[model samples]
Each structure stands twice: as structure tokens, then as C-alpha cells.
Target: MRYTLRQIEYFIATAETGSITLASERVNISQPSISTAIAHLEQELDTQLFVRRHAQGLTLTPAGKALLVEAKRLVEHAQQLYEVASEANDKIRGQLTLGCMVTLAPMIMPELSHAFTSAFPSTKVMQVVGDHDTLLQKLASAEIDVAITYDLHVPEGFDFVPLASLPPHVLVGEIHPFARLSAVTVKDIASEPLLLLDLPISREYFLAIFMQEGLTPHIAARSPHQDILRTMVANGYGYTLANVRPRSDTAMDGRKVVRVRLAGDHRPMVIGLVSPKERRKSRLIELFENHCRNRISDAYIPGMVAPVMEKRIRLD
Candidate 1:
């Protein structure tokens, strides 16, 4: 039973996208090629890997699930080997795939990209934006080198380092009553219609605000797209809860959205850099990680902000 690394790569891609067509598009290969590779992999392993449906996408069988863990390990080992060989030649020229949440991507990526590029001109960086779960899956599979996101449930066998602490702020349409308030409290927000950022960790974090106040919020809508949520709040559809405050210059266009500090003791969101603990680090990954850490430390002053909530909020 000889399964090639290319087969594993295609399988992981299909697993991530859930559609052979989409996966092929992502990897820039033909759908028939991907399908053939998957079929060949199943034959070599002597198990049916995926259960296909007519309308829906494929789901991994038990055999597929078991093989995924080994596949990721194999891929990571191969990546580490490639990195070592590249460094042996005294060149840092290679791909650096990074994962980030939608919120942080817009604010921090510009500076990060510029600084990293200036320092390591040879390395090519690729950014993938997704929620926590999606990013973690990619990280585990060696598809992405690192992840930048809010510190949520840190899985076993992963290392995390804090980057910045963001304080929770209230976002309201200009016409909303709370927009006139100097500062608002969790209790005050309980009765208002709220548009929650529906990212995995964010949904839990925002809803936990209500739990802390011992009340359930009047949730208006939940979505993963930041733009959609922002537009919803800006158009007077509902208010939103966010840790990162909107920059004053970009706060409002014609939509008339205003950001206000939350009253009382609030939970600070700690965004961090995460990578697999068991995997051996390359010089490139180490250099990029250190640069990010230094930039974050210089940007955020700890005494100015409180610590994040220690309790984990379960959305599921």
C-alpha cells in the first residue's frame, strides 16, 4: 500500500473544501484528477474514504478520519525537510502560508506584510482568512504555517503566544438610543437588538457578555462576514459587540455607525499567534514569529488594558 504525498495533499484539499470541483479549483488541478487521486488512495488503503451524496458534498468515513491524522503528520514532516534543505543553501526563498481571522486580517495584515517583506525580501507570503476552526484544521494539516486569531480553546499539542489585547466596544447605528450614551454596560445591551459576529470564538465571547450579566441578549442576527455585520449595524438594523474598536477615521461613511466604550469591568480579547507544538520549527517560521511578537509588544501596553476572560464560552 504505497500512497503518495500528492494524494494526501489532494485528499486534504477536498476535505477542506468539501467539493472536488472547488478543491480542484483551489489547487489549480482538474476535478477528474482529484477524483482519480482520491479513488486511488482509497484503493491503496483498502477502505472507502469518503461517502458521496447527490446534492451535498462528501463526508469522511471512519477510515478517512483515521488517515487524515497520519496524512497531516506526513505533510508536516515533508515541509520541515524542504525548509531545512532551503536553509542549507543559505536562501529563505519559499512559501509562507498564514491563517488569520477576518477581523484581524484588515487591521494588522498591512503592517505585518510590509514589515516582513522588508526584512525577508526573498520569502513569499500567502494569507488565508477564515474562522478559528477552519484555520486550526489547516494548521494541523500543514497547509498553513501559522495562525493569528483570538485566544480561544487551545487544543492539546499546540503552542500559543499572545500578540495584542483588545477591549470590548459597543457599535451602534447613529439613530440607536445607546449611541448617545457615553459608555454602555452588558446589562444595558441585554435588551437591545444585537448583530453578533458569528465567528466560532467571537459568537461565544459576545454571548458570554450576556451570561456575565445573568441575562440573555436579544440577538438580531449572526454572521461570519465582518462587512455584513458592519453594514447591518450601520443601517440601523442592530447593534454589535466587538473587542477591537473601529478607528475614528474609518468609523463611519454615509452609514453613520458610532463606537462607544463598554461600561463596567469588561473582558479584553487577547489575539495571539498559534502553531503546532510537536512540529520542528524552521528558521523562516521562527523569524516571522519573533517579528510578529515584537511588533505586538511594542503596539500594546499591558497596564492600559485588562486581561481577557478566563472562562471559555461554548456556542455549540
Candidate 2:
């Protein structure tokens, strides 16, 4: 071969970090060595890999971007070689890539991922957060091995393993008119100004609450951030709907909010694991999937709280 895996490794690090200096720091190598490997790669491939700016970081050319996915896969496959040897001793040791929904990441990822790694010290998890559509796209493109997400717009070729049921709840300020209520129906809040959680499938699910009741939500504002929406609700900008509420009802800005059950019947979001149906499950993937099963359920989620309800969807 004209090039070495060391060259590919340096190439991927620089491409991801966007600078030879940062890539060297990440890989614990000298910046000059990193630069030399990438330069040699460019020579061997006869392509300009990155557009280098004097002060600014490097940006991948189209060719570099196209090859990045393959480079990452190659690294993952290389890691799998260790797993093969590890299997002789019945050890689960390899890296697993997880793509999580942005909103869910803060609520669940830290405890879930950390605990899994803690359980298997030799194993590691790398997470990338995005919206519903983005996570699904990454799953399709082989960028992520598994997705910890809500069941939303899941395409035909993906498998969703339901983990927990998050029923809808309403957020209101401590002084808001709805705070004293035990529960409120869709029609009761349908006319109230809504601070919508504006995300791809999330918004659709929230709006569907009103739609199923044959009413229109009076949307006053929209935000992609959950905390922002909570803060807005705390300050009485408007009420918002959510499935996951942090254990504490206080916003980051030190404002208190209340989570009131969205009363009566409506569709709730099911949080679960998603993966390509056709893909063969790797051992690391299996370990992570099993970890999720133990850590996430209607009875408990790692770092988030759900409203108490009599009925819940159980994993069978």
C-alpha cells in the first residue's frame, strides 16, 4: 500500500478537529508529525485534503469530506480486531458510537453513557447529539452504531426498541393560573399561548396533542431548546408541553416551573433505541443495548423524571 493506517489516523484526527495543532493534542503527537502524515496522504492520494487558512483552522475539501466516513469506519473496524481477541476471554471491550436526540442528551446521556463505561472499564462510548431527523440520517449513513431516541419519523429500515414511556406534561410558572390544577385537558390549554418546543418530530408530537382534540394551539413562541422553553414558561412568556421534565422544576436562570399532567387521553412519546434493521449487531453494540435496557424503563430513567401515571407502556 502507498499509504499507512497511521496516515489515515492523522487525516481523520485533523479532519475532525479542523486543525493540525488540535489534532496533535487529541492524539498526543507532535503537530509537525501530524502535518507530515497528512501531507504524505495528500501526496499519495493526489488530492488536496483540506483548505488551510493561515490563522483559522483547516476545512475539508469535498474529497476529504467524502472520505471521512470511510476513515472512521476503518478505525472502528480496527478496534473490532481487539474485540475478536477479547472474545477468547469472554470480554466485551470496544468503542460504541451513539447518536442521541439533542433534547434527550442532557436529560439521559451523561448517566447512561458514564455508567455503561464504568461497568466495562475497557469499553468507551462516543456520543453525537442532533435532532430526530439528523440522528436518523446518521444511522442511515453508518455514522452512528445506535441511536437513543424517541420513536419519531423512524424510517422503514430501522428497528426501534421501546425502553420507556414518557407521557406528555405541561409546564407553567409557579404563579401561572394552571399551577394549582391537578391536570388540564387539551381543550383547556388549547387557547392558552403556547411556547412550543420547536424540533422536527417533537413539534409535530406536541402539536398533535391539540390536533387529536380537534383544536388549534395558540402558539405564541417556538424554541428548539428545552431549557429555554422552560425558562420562558417560568417567566410566564407562555406555557409549554414536554415529555421529559428534570427532577428539579427550576430553570437554569433560577426560576421555578411546575409540571402539570396533560390530563385525559393523548399520544405519548416512547423513548427507545434505534438501529438499522439490516446491520449485524456487534458485541459492543449488544453490550450497550443491554445496558440501556437495564438503565432505562418506565420504572426508572437515569437522570430524568417522568410524571406519575397509573398506566404505562411496558417492554415485553
Candidate 3:
């Protein structure tokens, strides 16, 4: 025996209204047609679906209650299918999933959130934060619509759009001797204890800077959380080298920590927008990416923009 979607819709309508006359009016069919459809459905399932009496309307039997649950679900799924099809034919209004690297999440997310929400009020935006490799995997699997991250050794199936360059700077404890200086040379940092950011790509970049200067940093502590390294530096634990500056104004407590320019030609970090190469461009993603590019360009300063020509190796 086979049941049809129209039969399920009639079943749900009758269950909701409790009167064959009202259900018929709601479904825009004759009352006898509604009754016949319900009778046919009950016969197909070999169960009594309704208990009827004179002028008392109808009540569901135990079997009727169970069938009603499945009937409602089927109707809902059918409606959802229609809604999805209609939305696909129209503009972007569904949910959009995005991912970003941990460091970039703090610095650029606020602006992106405000702009995207204001422009596309109906669209729902969901964000996931992870390291570069993890986000890359998600983007490739279509789990995320796009990713914003540092321009590292990107995988082959991804296309990158250069957004901005965050030059490397030295963060020193406010109480540290060098904090009083406006800027310090490689010789000064090379002799001091260094707190490393410990992220694979960032660590490699910093180590390369020292190698280029013909010196080795005295390593003290390593951390993945930038805030932890900042707090440690605030207490004069040690200094760290970072490319992205903190967007917040606290500066790790208004005192006890400061950022100073690092000497020598350390390669600047290239930050950019990343997305899967094969995926069709989404309007929402394009809007957000354009906002990022505009914000970065407006904030650009001569000698501060890191060139994208830096070479990197894929660690994964």
C-alpha cells in the first residue's frame, strides 16, 4: 500500500482542526473528499484513526496519535523542501558558515560582523574559529563558506586574495628595561629572554628573522594563546615578537606592557582572505571579503603593508 503527500496533508489538517468541515475549508477541498482521504489513509495502515460522534467533531485514537506525529513531520519536510527551492531561486537569505584563524578572529571580526549584519539583515552568519590547518580542512570539505587567515603555505585547491599586511613588532613588559626605549635593535632582543607565540607557522617566521640576523634568541616560555603571552610579558616574564597587533586598547593593562618597533628587516606577516578554489563565489562571502579589503586598505600605512611575496612551507 502507498500513501501520498496530499493524503498526509489532509491528515495533518484534520488532526489540527478536529472537524472535517473546517479541515476541508482549510485545505480548500470538499468535506466528503477530506473524509474519504482520511478513511483511505486509515484503511491503508489497517488502524482506526478517529472516533466520531454526532456534532462532537472528532478525537484521535491511540493509532491516530502515532500517525499524526509522522504526518506532521512529512508535511514539515515537504514545506522545507519548497522553501529551500524558492530561496535558491531568489537572493541569499539562508545561513552562511565562515571560519577564521585564531589571531585574525580578534582583530578583524568586529568590523566584519557589524558590516555584514547591517548589509544583509535576513542572512544568518555563523563563525568557527580554529588554527590555519584546521580551518583549511573545514573550507575544503564545504563545512565553512570562507576563511580569513594569514597567508601561509596555502593548499593547492584554495584561492587567496591579499587583504592586509601586519608588520612584526616587539611586545615588552612595561617594567622591562627596553620598554622605556621607543624602539630597539635586533641585538637588544637577541640578548633578552624571549617568550614565543608557539604557533607552528608563527614560530617558524620568528625563528627565520633571528637566523637572518646571525643570532639566536634566548627562549624562556612558549604559548599558543596570545593573551597568555601578553599577561606574562605584563609581569615582566619576557618579551614576544608578533605580527598582528591587538585591536583592543587595554594594551595588556595600560601599564607593564608596550609594543615597540623591531629593527632589522624581519619579513612582515601577510594576512588575507581565503576560500576554496572550486566553490562558486557566494554574494555574502564576497560582500564580507570586500569589506575586509576596504578596511585594510584604509588602514594601510607606507612601509607597514607587508608584501605578499614571502615564501612559506606547508606544515600539514
How close is every model to the real structure, measured as TM-score? 0.74, 0.86, 0.65
- In the range 1-316, model 3's lDDT, one tens digit per residue, is 4878898878877886689997887667999889899999988999999999768899989999989887766765664564466468865454566787887677666667656777767666667778888888878756577887888668799998877776687888767888787678888889788999888677888888888888999999999988788888887888998876663424555555677778667667777778988877655566667766776642551222222322111111
Give RMSD (Å) of candidate 3 vs. truth.
14.8
How are the candidates ranked when ordered by lDDT, highest leading?
Answer: 2, 1, 3
RMSD of each: 7.0, 4.2, 14.8
Off by over 4 Å in 2: 1-10, 13-40, 43-46, 52-70, 307-316
* Candidate 2 per-residue C-alpha lDDT over 258-305 given as tens digits, one digit per residue, 9 for 90 to 100: 987787887778999999999988878988999899988887887776
Q: After superposition, how far is residue 168 of candidate 3 from its true place, in Å?
A: 0.5
Q: Which 10 consecutive positions of candidate 1 have the poorest summed lDDT?
A: 307-316
TM-score of 1: 0.74
Candidate closest to the true structure, highest TM-score: 2
TM-score of 2: 0.86
Give the per-residue Cα lDDT of candidate 2 at 196: 93
Better of 1 and 3 by TM-score: 1
The true-versus-predicted C-alpha distance at residue 275 of model 2, in Å, is: 0.5
